[model samples]
Target: MMRIWPVFRRELVGYFATPLAYVFIVIFLFAMGASTFYLGNFYEGRTANLERFFLFHPWLYLFLMPALAMRLWAEEKKTGTIEILMTLPIPAWASVMGKFLAAWAFSGIALALTFPMWITVNILGEPDNGVILASYIGSFFMAGGYLAIGSCLSAATNNQVIAFVVSIVVCFLFTVSGLPLVLQVAQAVLPTPVVSAIASFSFLTRFEAIAEGVIDLRDVIYFASLILLWLGINVALLERARAG
Candidate 1:
């Protein structure tokens, strides 16, 4: 934790040192608000819940998370500063976790700033705030999962565009894994257990479970494991990249 702080602090500030942070926040806010009001029929539906708001997150993060993750390692390589940073007196794990945590925290900030929507709902009528809070929690974990994936994919190449493309493709596959259409295809050839396994990997399934106030331990564990698994891959990829 001690060794990771400086890197975390540096990376977090780096986000805001330019217009990228503001741009990201603005885009996120616009997407959320527009999706809720237009596609979700926020006014027409007489409800105080943010169900419509949260529902669009998986699709929203599909494009956004990769954009955030594409620069983590890709920019380091592009500018040739990765060599200096890699040789510093820091554990590779520390570097990996620090960068990832910084990115995750940035994601959390973006999510938190959407609280106005929550506030708007409360003013209109009584809604279960607990469910809204749980949805926020689930969304952050899901963002971490997406960012970790982006981190690993970014490490595999120095091209940010390529990193972004690969991360989108991978995240999309995970998001659709549990959909009826995907399940239908998997069950056609795969065994029952294999089909079930594919369904378990679905981000939408686990996220919806939490968003609906079903805070089961299994759903939480699934997101945690997803983040850890991809982050471990991130560490391994960075180690190899540093060596080469």
Candidate 2:
């Protein structure tokens, strides 16, 4: 943890040192507001809950997470700073975890900025704040999953654009794995157990389960495992890069 702190702090502070952080925050907040109020019809629903607001989180993170992750290692490699990073005394795993955690925290900040939606719902009517809080937790985990995937993909390539596009495509597959359309396709070529496994990996499914107010241990474990798996791969990719 001590070895990771400097890298984490450097990466996190680097975000606010530029306009990228502000731009991302503004875009994220606006997108959340528009999706919640206009696209989701929060007022027309007449429900006090933030179901509409939380519902859009996965889809929103689809684009936003990749955009954030594309720069993690891609920009470093492109600018040739990755060599400097590689020379640091920190272990590769610590660097990878530090960078991933920094990006995840940045995303959490953006997510937290949407608290007004929660405030608005409370002012309008009594709602299950517990369920809402659970949904927030689920959304944050889901974002971490996306960022982890993107982080690995970013490390795999020097082109940020390729990293962004590939990250989106991979994240899309994970997001839709539980849907009938994807499951149907998988079931055709695969056995029942395999199909079931594919469905279990769906970000939407796990998140929706938690959003329903049940923070099932399985759901938490699933997200944690997914993040760790991808981060492990991310470290391997960086190790390979250093070797080459």
Candidate 3:
């Protein structure tokens, strides 16, 4: 825990030490605001629900979360700092947890910055704050899951651009698995139950429930399990790399 603190601090500080954090925040807010206000017609129609805003999150995170996580291990390896980092007195899992938490928290801040849209809804009408809160929680967990995948991929490569691209591809498939395009493709080659089972693994399927104000325990557990599983893989990859 103590070791984790320093690592967390270091990673968190690293996020703000460059233009990446600010650039990401600005673009995130702009895209979210534009989607909700302009494309979603929230203001023009004066709808109180956050449906439009929440709807855009999966697509938004599909790209943005990977960008946020691309540097976790890839940059370390590219700079030849992976060895130095691994040699620290901290446990590998602790380091992984700390870095994961830092990236997750950064994504949380970006998500939180969308609160003005919430304020807009409340001022327009009586939006359910409970539902809004649940959506935010679900979104954060979804982002964490993506970041965990990115972290593992980043560990497997020494190029940040490659890490970012691979993470985006993997995360895109995860988000779209439940969509008609992917489901249709799966149904053509697989049994009905198998196709349904594969779609059930989609991030969108779980997020839709939360966006609608229902926090199913299964969805929460799924996201948590995803993060843990990917982080475990990330640690193993790094350990293997260290050994080889």
Identify the superior model by lDDT, candidate 1 or candidate 2.
Answer: 2
> Model 2 segments beyond 4 Å from truth?
none
- Cα lDDT of model 2 by residue, 174-197, tens digit: 999999998999889999999999
Give the winner by lDDT: 2
Q: Write model 3 residue lDDT over 116-166, tens digit each, in one string.
A: 888878888998999999999999999999999998999899999999999
- Residue 25, candidate 3: Cα error in Å is 0.8
TM-score of 3: 0.97
TM-score of each: 0.98, 0.98, 0.97
In the predicted model 3, the residue pairs found to clash are none
RMSD of each: 0.8, 0.8, 1.1
Superposed by TM-score, candidate 3 places the C-alpha of residue 181 at a distance from the truth, in angstroms, of: 2.1
lDDT of each: 0.92, 0.95, 0.91
Task: List ranges where model 1 is wrong by over 4 Å.
Answer: none
Worst 10 residues of 3 by lDDT: 38-47
